[model samples]
Every structure is written in C-alpha cells, then in structure tokens.
Target: MSGDEKGPVLQFATFQSSVDEGFWHGLSSLKLNKLKTDETPISIMGFYTPCSNPHVSSHLTLLAESLPTEPSDGLPTATTHGNRNKCSVPGTLYNTNTLEGYQSLDKKGLLQAEGKKIWEDIRSGKAEEDSSVLLRFLVVSFADLKKFHFYYSIAFPAVVLDPPATLVDLRPASEWFTLEEAESVSACCNEWRMSSLTADVPFFLVCISSNSNATIRPLKDFKACQHEDQKILFAFYDPYHGPNNPGWPLRNYLAFISARWNINKVQFLCYRENRGFADLGLSLVGEALIQPSQAWQDEEHVPKVIGWELNKERKVSRRVDLSTSMDPTRMVVSAA
Candidate 1:
C-alpha cells in the first residue's frame, strides 16, 4: 500500500519532543538489563475474535495457519543483552506489523532468532508446554488505537495477554481494575489519509462494542493477571458503558499500565453523534480501522463496528460515516 493508503503513520520512536525520547530510553534500558528481563521471560501475545476485527483476526489466523514447516534455526551470535551472557526475550519490536514494544529507529539491527522454534510449535498446533509459550512477546495492531503511545504509556499491563489468568467478567460493571498510582502520558493522534480529500485527515477513536475474548477472564482478579510469576495489568470494557468521559473505567485502563510504568494515553475524535463507548479505553487495542487510504473513509474497507450497552441487546453500527467525515462525492470505499 502507498503511504497515502498508510495514513500519517508515526514511527514509535518518532516522538514530537523530548517526552518521546525519554519513553524509548526507558523501554530500551529495561530490555538490556539481564537482572530485570532474563527471568522475566516476557512472552507477549494476544488474539481478538473475528467480530472485534475481521481483517486482523483473518490476518493473524492466516499467518498462524499458513506457517510453512519449521525452518532451520539460525545460529545464535556472540551478542548478549548488555555485558551479561544472557539474552532478553525477542530481540526487538522494530518494524513488527503490530504496534507496542517496538523501536522503528533501530539501526543496530536486532534479530529474532530465539522464538523461531516456539513460533513453529505455535503454528504447527502442537505447542509444547514451555516457560515462554508461543510468542516471544505480544501482538497489538496499529488499527487498534492507531498509535503506540497508549500500549506503553497508558495501557502498559493490558498490552499482553495472560492466557492462564482467571478470566475477568467482560461486562461493563464487572470490568474495571484500579491502580493506586499511574503516570499520565500525552494523548497523541496521527494524521490519516482520505481517499476523496486531498487535505490531511485525522485518526478516529473507534470504540469496540464486542469481542470473542470477552468470554475469558484474562485479567484474573480484576486487580491484575499473571502468566507465571509476573504481575500483568488488564481491563475488560463494557460495550455501552460511559467512555465519552475518562472516568474510573478509562482511568483504570491507564492505571493498569501506570501501576507498572508511565504510559502515554492517546486522544482521538469520536466520529458519530459521540454516542460510542467512553467508559474505558480497553477497546482501543482491539478496534479495527481499515481504509483504502489513510483517511479510514473508504466504505469497502470501512468495517462494521457492532456494540451494545448493558441496558440493551447488542447492535451493529458503523463506527464512522464517510459522508460525514470525508468528501461525500467519492467517499465510499470500494472493494474493487
């Protein structure tokens, strides 16, 4: 896809100021410390049902199912994490199709040689019981919130899926975990592309109404989840709860990450009558925004965003109306 179709993509490291700079440094420093990461063994991975995002679910499923038989493992190099003779999890998150925990400006060239066997086991469907599981780390989509700030800054603990946790109830009233203290990051939005308009468009905050994972309690006790010994953060959002204002649910999402580290939450425009979920930002990581151009206005690619409130049954709705947000003349996204 052309850059136009890609929209105003922000390299996670490409921050607007020193704030962005310090963020990357903290992440990088943590990765290199053997004392902090070696035993940590952070095997990050996540999955969403077809309903939350058909495109992404399809993309992830296709990759998982399309795995060619395990290829030969590349030999490990002399390089080690810091001066200690140990390796961290997967080397880098740079250029990973999914966002979160990645460094786009990485010039030293980090390679993921460790997870090849685990990756194969996962794809082959006979994942052996291992300490790190299948993925070396997590996989959150850019379409979720359109930026990496939140996954790190605001949604720190929510970033990874702890499959072993005693799943939290996903219902609105039942789905909030509070942090005693959490650092707040600036909400940043990237410029998006419009198929019909020549001027720059912006990213829309499309909230999630439902998802397949809703049934599981990945968040455990609602206070935190654990994959082994590590304490992880999680928040299950209600489709129709109050998200317009950053209340407990929204603040709780930030708190989950904040309890671990300072994370940056993002700001976005609600395209509809602003009736979408504002109760929590948990939906941001699961949202799908597919557009012919970066503008997210193409109808063909414009996904159906279905949601429901606690007081009512679930309903399907268009997250945005191209006719309202972009040039109506040729606003519809054609599949052709």
Candidate 2:
C-alpha cells in the first residue's frame, strides 16, 4: 500500500456482466493484464430485476457470460460459471435461440410489446414466466480492497434484449498511442477545438493515472504534496449521444487511488475548471496570447478534458500527444 509499491490501478464502475467476458477479452487482447480480474474493486453500484421464466433466466445467464470477465464479481452465479443448478433458476442461452427470438421479436414487433409485458409481469409476479430478475452492476477497482456492489433498476429496452449487443462488440476508437506519438506531443502546444455533440448533456472526463503509486487524496487535502508524474488515460461521453458515445463513456472514467496509501501526496485527474469560462462570456483572465496558423484554425474534435501529468513542482505534462495523432486536415484534438 506504500507509494512505491503502488502500480497503475484501473478503476471504473461497470455492470458485473461487463467485467466477465467483454472486459477480459479487451484487457487480455490488449495485453493489459496477465490475469483477468486481478484488479481489486474499491466501490460498486448495481441494480437487479428478477426473471419470471426459467428459459428467460437461462438466456440472461448466457447474455451475462457474453460480457467481459474482469468485472464479474457481482453477476449472478449461474451466469458467471455456467452453473445453472446452483441458482434457484438456471439461466442459459443458445445462439440459435437468441437469433430466432430476436428475429421473431423484430418481425412481429413482439420485442417491444413483449418487452413491456415482461416488465409488467416481472414487477407484478403475475406473468407465467419462471422468475423475474433485472440487475445493474457497478464496480470500482483499487490495487487492493476492490469494491463491488449490485442493485435493481427499472428494466429498459436494452435490458430486455438478451446480452445487449453494444457491450459485446466494442472497439477502442484509437489504439494505445505508440511511444513516439506520446513523446512528440509532450512539448507541442497548439490551439485545439472541441465540440460536444450534446451541449445540454454533461460529459465525463476520465483520467487513468500513469503513476502506479498515485493515490487519491481527499479533496480537502489534495493541494499539499507534489510528484505529479502520472500516466493519464482520457475519454469523454454524453449518454444522450444515441446508442453510445463511441468510447467517450470509457474514456471519461476516473480512477481515484486509495488515500490510505499516501496521506500527503493526494492527486486525482479532472477537467480544467476554467474551460467553460467562455460559455459564460467572462472577460479574459489576463493578457491573452493569440497565435494563428492554418493548423490552429482547423476544427479538431478533442475530449472535453486534456490528460496530462502534474509534477510535484506543479508543472503539467501531456500524456497522449494528440498533436501527431490528430487529423491534420481538420486539426481536431479528438480526445474521446
């Protein structure tokens, strides 16, 4: 738990199913971890709904298995281990069964109608189905003492569908930056343009600290210590952005290191507080420096937050050098 022993800690709140197969595949294929689900959870929030029918329960289990494995701590046991007998109702699914059900639901509008009926039935326990169950999973990881929590929420269309498709098939918008790209953007300063597709929606600014030993000091005590050399992963998202915000949701994820590790050096990543100052039309803080270049004028889409390192001296360093990775033509900062 000492600062020296702390390594990069991946922390995010996600459904239990998300950490199962979907998470494991991404981390493993990306070579993020030698062992899946090795990170510990610091906190978790989840919701659940009961399944009314044994068959539906089985399908739910199958769907859960399709998700990533790293966040599997809170999922139903039947889904986690292919163990139907252990649970009061065993959940299972077959590809053919799923496909046929989807096709039928789509053709007859049964998906929508039946989905509504299923919701009513589950809540009322009147439907002839076996048992009703719907759940949400939230998980957070620390190097140690990882946290996992689960709860129940109203079922939505996405939940009715077996193993929501979005979770299973997702790709990182940009590959992990190469060492060269990371270095070049380190020193370059350029005018960056960013636009949130949804102005009304609040977007998340996620930063994964590169410093293995970095700990999240309480907000009250954060300003004291230094040593800001942290590798930061950045992403942004507006849930209102249709099916998904590309990788914005994932990018905006924030990891707060354990405060117990280091009481003095408290640090966490977040958006520049003054960013929206212009939206308020506030006067410039002081003399403003203006530089013009075709590159500067080019419209580039960057995340709302820039990921950088702040040294103990309070000097900031860029993590992913966007200067080179950006689309030169549009001159977009493209954070998410």
Against the true structure, whose lDDT is highest?
2
Candidate 2 CA-lDDT value = 0.22
**Quick one: best TM-score, which candidate?**
1
lDDT of 1: 0.22
Off by over 4 Å in 1: 6-112, 126-214, 217-336
Error of 2 at 208 (Å): 9.9
TM per candidate: 0.19, 0.17
Score residue 221 of candidate 1 by CA lDDT: 32
| Predictions in order: lDDT | 0.22, 0.22
- Model 1 RMSD in angstroms: 22.8
